[model samples]
Target: MDTGPETGTGTSEQTTSQSARPGYKQLLRTADAWTFLLPGFAARQPFAMLTIGIVLLVQHTTGSYGSAGVVSAATGVSMALFAPQSGKLADRFGQGAVLLPGVLVHTAAIAALISLALAHAPLWALLAAAVPAGASVPQVGPMVRSRWAVKLNGSPLMSTAAAFESVTDEFTFVVGPVLATALCTSVHPAAGLVAEAALTLVGGLLFAAQRRTAPVPSRLAGGGTRHASALTVPGVRVLAIVFLGIGSVFGGMQVSLTAFTQAIGEPGINGLLYGTFAAGNMCAGVVCGAIAWKVTPQRRLLVAYPLLTLACSTLWAVHAVPLLGALGLLVGLCIAPSLITGYTLVESLVPAAARTEAFTWLTGAVALGQAAAATVSGQLADRFGASAGFLVPLGGTALALATLLTLRRRLSTTRQDG
Candidate 1:
């Protein structure tokens, strides 16, 4: 029942002990934390690879960006629909019980998709394979965050942990795409997906094996009543919507960048450019986590959302490849701080019983946004060219900003014991 201080109140209660704010060296010394973190981090590598991998693989085989978009979107749609159910199962059972089976099914599905794509199977077959591939994606990120919540509960280190996870996510996105692109372009279009399947199996097993840190199933205090769904939680609903917008920005950027590079005769460089975008987020996330903020998480989000909107809007005008890369880096600056704060707020809002499910809802929103953005952006790129597709992210950013403004008051109610 110990939540940290309410953010953005500008009071001494919001501050933490000096010792709680450990340096990077001291942070790593928490060996048990890393044991839980590393495997999940490895598992996440495939998340970044899958969407782009499908795009590249299908596009190469069918020679149509729209087909590639639909195939990739199918995965997102499946993940979006099924992620919450998986998380709820993890919460009811345990990480290992859910993840082991999930990983097996997910890996097998990805393999099937790869085989189908390599053989130039019908588009419907490829799309059908994507369903189980995505639906069975182990909820690694949410599970890890939930573990952090349990491990760091009632401590100031919660913010630091959130920042670390956010940075880890950015880092994975940075490397995953580059690695996938290299494997696809140099080896074969299916190489990236094959590698993703391998990583999922290895990392999922390693992460699930750490039973000591896994969260115990929730039980009511005085009775055996079940907890309400995370969907019914007020703040969770708001944040999920916001996350949807953020996901759209990311999805649109990825698909548009691919089309742009392909148009400019540098399809191979798409990963590098995407890495540049994530590089900015990684660097900022490191700094954001290290520093103690005086403002509430809501205040930080208010500022960060507008900045993201402005940054994404600028992409609409970017024509030159080098300038676009630079703009991508600039646009990435606010992403980490926003996400770090958003997750922290989500932590404050939901009770421990529904923590994993709540976090998974956030991830589901992102997947939903990605599903919509990939299809829409790809269509725009095909019809109006790549730069024109930037409008999708721009529109998403604007809508996110509006959502925040509308819900600002509700989000500001972040108390330590909510």
Candidate 2:
């Protein structure tokens, strides 16, 4: 039996062979490709910025990185818990119906959180504001992937679409953090959150307006009956765990970089260092998409994940800024392959009806891991130092690697289900 994604096409081997070759130019020219892509990119930029912005503002207000991490973690935790539900609603209803109200709520919630932070309200008040802000985050990334799946369901270009989306995500990370950090440090502590809110409102509206390209609601696609959650699939669970490890790397890096820069008495360089790491991810994504590969996504994922762990292991030992930046770039380079592969595997693992929900579960797991890492790393950095904070990524990825090794067989998708 063929082990590749069942793209609904009978010629799995032929399609898989074609997928290994470059065809991004063809993907770009697909009908209505840019109609949603531009707005979707704009809408998701806040996803990368929100947590870091919260961290900066709260730290500035409270004079405690630990406090900052706790607040941001609350936001991330809420997002993790609620994002999948949002996706489920989108699958049943429509993306526009779900996104419009979500963006509105998110903007108001973020504004409230910023105001309370500036007012020096109690942490409980801030946490209350954070939960809604996070819970209301628009599920743009997963929604966009769902659209791509609709557009190129069984086409060989679907693999390229995954790579392209990964590249787009990395690019947003590259821009979002640098923009947030610059705004926060150079302008005002709350400037980043303000910008994030504005972008979410405007971009979310624009993306929601593009109803022409939106996937048909599963309720409409199928019968009116309810669909099961994506987590029912064992592969989704495994992938979600893998993404959590990746999220820990992101969270640990954010806090540890802040501490490292502040320790050197040049806190402004934190953005540049993080940007360098993000640039590595974007570069790798570009290359990953362009190459033709005969190896399956599962095998590619297994290879890439161990490399990510090995790269992260050295993060705790680096003290010099340049050395740390170099190490960060290396770590970033190892990340895209695993991310791209995991996403590619999802096409074969989950049914089309629950695709959006499956994507959100993986995305939410990242947010959840990032939240946990940010909290622990922040506390460690405050009491111990930045070096201690850096250990979180290594520890998270190592544990995940062990899990992957133990449950490697579960990662395979022998059949696709809806």
Could you tell me which residue pairs clash in candidate 1?
7-296, 8-295, 8-296
Model 2 residue runs over 4 Å out of place are: 1-21, 416-418
Pairs with backbone N, CA or C atoms under 3 Å apart (clashes), candidate 2: none
lDDT of 1 by residue, 136-192 (tens): 988899999998777666456667778888899899889998999999999999999
Q: Report the number of the highest-lDDT candidate.
A: 2
Per-prediction TM-score to the true structure, in the order listed: 0.93, 0.95
Q: For candidate 2, lDDT tens digit of each residue in 1-418?
A: 2111233433543454346445788778666779999999999999989988999999999989899999999999999999999999998898999999999999999999999999999999999999999999999999999888776766667778889999999898899999999999999999999999999999999999998778788777777866678898888889999999999999999998998898989989888999899889988988888776789888999999999999999899889889999999999999999899888888888887888899999899999999999999999999998889999999999988888888889887764563
Give lDDT for model 1. 0.83
